[model samples]
Target: MFGDLTGIMGKLKETQKKIEETKKRLDSVLIDESSSDGLLKITITANRQIKAVDIAPSLFEDREQLEDYLVITLNKAIEKATKVNEAELASVAKDGMPNIPGMDMFK
Candidate 1:
């Protein structure tokens, strides 16, 4: 029984390492989002770090409109980044997990 526990602990540690590695990898995965009119564009990492933003000169004519575009586009980019981050991390964790009898958390 102790041996089994030790093996499970070791597996858990390995899984944690893989999850960390995946998180680092996700830092490089970029998600791009644009406004409906294509006046604003945002790029973010799967880790939800903003990488770049490109705005069309037309959006500069109105401050409120530019702010609204930024809000909407950034939110969309963040949502997409979150989805990618979660999926990638979950995949790594699930694949590396040990087959413990009562551990069906992934399902």
Candidate 2:
């Protein structure tokens, strides 16, 4: 029984190590999320850092148009970012838990 417990413990430790490693890999990686019907653009890192932001001249010409498109584009960008991040994370945890409880929000 003691030997079995040790084996289980070792497995758990390995799992935890894998999880930590995956998280570290994710942190080092970056996900670029941008939006702009060819106008406003942005690059976001995996850690949620804004790498770059650009705005086109035409984007400022029409305030209303810019605002509407900016909102839509930003929404789309954020959605894309979330999906990409989740997919990357999933790729790391291929054999572990699909969606850890309470950790769903992070994904």
Worst 10 residues of 1 by lDDT: 92-101
Name the regions of candidate 2 deviating beyond 4 angstroms.
32-36, 96-107
lDDT of 1 by residue, 1-107 (tens): 99999998999999999998999999999999999888899999999999999999988999999999999999999999999999999999899888988989998
* Number of clashing residue pairs, candidate 2: 0
Q: Each candidate's root-mean-square deviation in Å?
A: 0.7, 5.6
lDDT of 2 by residue, 24-106 (tens): 66565655544534677766555445666677888788999888776776666666666766776666555553333565543
Give the TM-score of each candidate: 0.96, 0.60
Candidate 2 least-lDDT 10 residues: 97-106
lDDT of 2 at 88: 64
